[model samples]
Target: MAATSLSLQIDARWRAATTPPDRPCGMEDIETASSSVVIVRGKEADGSGFWVTPSIVMTNNHVVDHNPDLKVGKDFPATVLATDSVRDIALLSVPNVYPEPVPLRGIEEMPRLADDLYVIGHPIGRNLTVSKGIVSALTNDDYDDRQYIQTDAAISSGSSGGPVVDRCGRVVGMATQTLRGAENVGYAIAWSQLSSHMDRMLKVVEGSSPEERELTYPSDQTEVVAKYYSTLGAGELAEAYDFYSASRKARLPYESWAQGLGKTVFIRLVSVTPGDKSNSVKVHFYSTEEVNAETWEWRTGEFEGTWTLTREGGLWKMNESNIKDITKPTTSP
Candidate 1:
């Protein structure tokens, strides 16, 4: 939809939503703004982002550090245009992106402590979910002489790069993370700290594409890939769980993921080849598993597939995988 078609009135510049204090939070404006909010998925990134320009989306840097194949919800493909590691913010170029860009307002009237906050996003990547919170505190950051919005909102894994909106659904801040071991203690990059930086990033450079950049693994992935399947076969479930990237973990739950692998008896790595993209690799393997739920008999099958791995905490972790069973019933482990 075009900017003029929007019902909610803003300044001529589309910088801010001018919602009066008396207006209730659950209004038509918010529902309309939800259409602009989109779920983002990449090999290593899974989160939410909002359009800043017609085709430019705003998300967190960690969400798309590597500009690999990215999907916006299920509607459009996207590419990273810029990233700010210090602010944990990223801008994406989504061609023919839908809805309209969220208002990028001045921080003149910044969200104060104890102010109400809300987020409308697909946190678990299922359906649009709503979370209500209050600005607990504004923590100062030495990094950029800016402040962070600390709120008691439900900012989980997939909601990391989502927009934290005000009662009027105006973009107040960007959801970054939840405090570990704390209940509902989420932190966001305050609008006061983001407005200028976001504009600067847009001006500096257009992000590189896979063909333009010679991407490389931080370390050799041979051993890491081998260890992953072998660990699963050994039933070292706890250790195997650590091999998944943050986004992969969010997409899959431990209980369900573990249950699915229960029948695995052994997996032997066969061949590992570099994929077309440096961050990805082609892997071939054979697996031996119990024949069925009622049987102890074992069977083996040959498999070939590709995997996307990312460097997380100095270790290579599986971000995504697409494996195919190429063996017949007579295949061996």
Candidate 2:
């Protein structure tokens, strides 16, 4: 009798809609973007991946390269272009072009603790499922320099290699694993850790197949935000700084500007809304870290700012002078 009741309860939840019918929280756009995510099947396991470029998909190395039959760059659905096992990020070239490539956030734009985030993946062999959560923490592997984005977003057996995006619908990390005995604790390879290898990720696909001939890069405004932050997170300071307009960069030289970013542990975009003027975005951020060397304790707080981005030569660049801070600081243990 008890087993029967439990079975019925589980059935009811599954029968519930995978997504809300009303499509709240910009869920509609997120669902559409998820079209880029794909199921990666290997000899030993099945995982998920999303397109980074027209024909190139990014996923976990273990998902496609763990078993003997799933060799990178030689597999059928995707060829492995590059792999960083330490970060668990892999780049692959698919035979076809993907229409929607998810936008990735820069490392320097790390999500703040407790900020709402989401993950889309094929958990437990089911089709795509989007699970939501908050940024729980930023953790590091004791053995290496790699950092992990810890969130409560549910990550199941087959969810590896999925994209974890912030409320702004920007990719911040790649789903990797869940804690063994925990319910909501999951980890992803922060995009910052994957940023440095992006050149190789794109380069490996150049001229490799006829699919490249048909590829087209979309200039979505949100994608620009994603790339800008992901570049910063990956520690490509020069590249990220270049996202600022030439005049802005000149006014705030790299050295002085970078120095102003002192000792940040993590930053999360709490909200991103369109600014008053065209091509402007109002960004609300939250960051957490030690306030001073003497305490060495962690604290979280909110930051509000606006950016005026302009399209130059078919690319977006930030107008840094327009940035403003609207922070509400609070300390928590």
Candidate 3:
């Protein structure tokens, strides 16, 4: 059966708050709706996704780009199940997730001019962020000639794949992109525009794939380590800590390891390749590190390192790092 046909309206239970445009939505309703949002991280893209079904997420295709080792919400492994890249839409299988699916508006209920809309996303891959705007002008923002929902709402970087929900908390559209150097000009592809496509995509009957997915040689290995460095450079010590193998964590306490890493402010990944063996990755990077933590003077350096990761509980954790060939740091992205 199709997940969409004639029924796409917000449930009667949610309609109670629809009459008041200025009144805040019920806290329980908004929180549950927001919980459907998730962080999407791939080697090339960072954005947000939302649960369209219990086990399936909808996002912008540019966010995943068919990345094999995509991570959704707190590092949960994800797989690209479908994509219509031209439309900037994609769906992924995210097993063992608990966020509830959100409602979508019917075509008859499409937003009109000045209709209030709220964009919920994780801008810059940060926490849940929401921006408010009205339906500006409905027109083609791309070559597809499809009508896109243009809003003044900030769909800044990292918020690209998030949900654009209505005042009733029903998903009206999917945040797609923003124009550089342009203010408050962001485009979204409405669900009503792709209801048929989504109806089929949302039927996620496949069982969860095994959590311990092996990397496919060079490409996967490089991206895995690169994501680690990306997190490190962002000063996400707690998240980086989880990447360490249990045995490695046993040897190096979090405080000590974080203290050591604190010396560097940022790491710019240059090149990464698979090592001679399947378990290793070689990295060439540049760092802008603090010379003295107190004075905060920084120095740049070029570096090379080999990282060994151990498979544990369906994920790879860092086992060892062999860093050498450290010439003075000049920056390379």
- In order of listing, the candidates' clash counts read 0, 14, 3
Q: Write the per-residue lDDT of candidate 1 for residues 1-333, one digit (tens) a residue.
A: 222222212235556344443656565655766777888888765788876666667888767754468888786877555555445677776665435455333243579888888876677666777688999998876423656789998998888788888767777888888888989899888876677776555433423223222222223454356556656776888777877899999999889899887578877666665688978878878888887766667878899999999877655678999999899765477
lDDT of each: 0.70, 0.63, 0.69
TM-score of every candidate: 0.56, 0.50, 0.52
Candidate 2 versus the native: TM-score?
0.50
Model 1's TM-score against the true structure:
0.56
Q: Write the per-residue lDDT of candidate 2 for residues 37-135, one digit (tens) a residue.
A: 777776777788876654557788668643334422224455555554334667765543434243332333677899888898988757789999989
In candidate 2, stretches whose alpha carbon ends up further than 4 angstroms from where it belongs are 1-25, 68-76, 98-108, 200-333
Enumerate residue pairs that collide in model 3.
300-329, 301-329, 302-329
> Lowest summed lDDT over 10 consecutive residues: which window, candidate 1?
1-10
Quote the positional error of residue 256 for candidate 3 in Å: 54
Best by TM-score: 1
Q: Residue by residue across 174-263, what tens digits does model 3's lDDT show?
A: 899887888999888976665555554333212112442232211144445766776678777787677788999999999898877657
In model 2, which range of ten residues has the least summed lDDT?
1-10
Candidate 3: stretches off by over 4 Å: 1-28, 98-108, 141-145, 200-333
Residues forming the 10-long window of minimal summed lDDT in candidate 3: 1-10
Q: CA lDDT of 252 in candidate 2?
A: 87
